[model samples]
Target: MRGLREWWRDLTDLVLPAECGGCGRGRTVLCPRCRTALSGAAPCRARPVPEPPGLPVVHAAARYADEVRAALLAHKERGVLALTAPLGVALAGAVRAGLREARWGPGDAGAVRARGPVLLVPVPSAPRAVRTRGHDPARRIALAAAGELRRTGTSARVLAVLRQRHAVADQSELGARQRLRNLAGALAVAPGGDRLLCGGGPVVLVDDLMTTGASLTEAARALRAARAGAKSAVYPSSAGEGREERKAGPRMAGPNEGGGVIREAICAAVVAASPDSFEINRN
Candidate 1:
């Protein structure tokens, strides 16, 4: 009888695709209530207690609970493509929030505009995971987020120049320190990636979620390595940064047009984070 009821509902709506990816509400891709939960909140600062080194100033759109958690899981693990837009919208808000707080220092809040279009750099997923999932969720969301930003008059674009240089163990079971150790120097900027960003705008690292933030920290380290035209021996060979990693890297020039480098770490954004992570900003 429950199955029959669902069938009838789908049949009547004529667009009854699937239940809400968020809350399983019948007859809709995403119900209004869950949609609000996912994208309604103003983005806020999120920081992990005992934050790992190299993790940038980070912001998150929603708390990872209730419908927000459900929607992200469905979209990432279950391949619900329809959730990408809404998730992207939420992520864009986080990116904007991060930019708003980054590097103004009592100056104009819009100072980021003076820099150039915003560039979104997504952390690369493992090739094994991408092959298993059949798509790169982070990259897709970054593209969607860039589209949303452009639509709203922000010059934003996705720059997927970072690559996973080594495979990492599953971080789900690891603690903060272990996660950081596992991800150390695991990412590298691709050839010519530095030139792409040399004359470009502010960069924001984008990802689906931030738990320990180990992934984003590694990404920032790689970007910094590329920008400075230096190879970082942040970890020993045990961390998997091999001899090839010692080669000269790309150069991400600063705004000075000559030999300047952006020394400060970049910001990062995510759809949701641990609920407690948001509490740091409540003050």
Candidate 2:
């Protein structure tokens, strides 16, 4: 089934060759200039206004403007799957910057091996959005990012364990506060997800773009809830376990041991963030 799907997609692409999503250049999904634009010189912090509670510190590879914006829309809304590779490369850079900011040390083999594999958890897409697009763009980019991370000696893997627990209204027309209200309590961790997060490596939420940051904030909440639930299950109210769980905090711990109550994401990475979020760094 997978092989057939791959062949069909390849054939479809050949039948309808793509132009650069950033520019109108023919015969390419993304031009070199646009790819470079997507990949900023360095990853930088991106914060949305009225940042929601539980929102993690975010890093983005580029501002969501001009070519970057066009490219993201093309890949996400238009199903230009070929753009995933370049976008993933951009995301990988942002993830690396996040790891550095979090003080995970160098990407050397020894350092990465010692730290185990970081988990890239892509923010879940609404069911309606996924159905309309016919593919989950965030997950595809996340998979590519993980591959890119592995090549750079930073052990990483994608864990798509977040799911929407309820429906949400379209967010494009909503203001920041409205978006927050709409998304609150909309997401939850899938069964068995907490075990993966407890694997002693930091969890970095991945997204294609971030505007108001409500989604990421909600995702962090879901993950923390899952961790807490898992810990409670194992500890079962023993005094010693309670003490240990309390000490665990939000830090990732060994799979066998509980990590306490997760309150926020370690960090988040995106292909781009709103242009306004980059202003401080620009100055």
Candidate with best TM-score: 2
Candidate 1 C-alpha lDDT tens digits along 1-283 = 9999988877865544468988897767789899889888888888887787667888899999999999998888888888899999999999988776654311343655676788999988899889988889999999999999989878889999999887889888999999889988789999889766665778899999998888998999988778656322222343543444334322223332244233353778999998988778767
What local lDDT does model 1 show for residue 85? 91
TM-score of 2: 0.84
lDDT of model 2 at position 277? 79
lDDT (Cα) of model 1: 0.81
Query: How accurate locally, in lDDT, is each candidate?
Result: 0.81, 0.83
Query: Candidate 1 — which residues are off by over 4 angstroms?
Result: 1-16, 103-114, 230-265
Per-residue error at 131 for model 1, in Å?
0.6
Spell out the clash pairs found in candidate 2: none
TM-score of 1: 0.81
Q: Clashes in candidate 1: how many?
A: 0
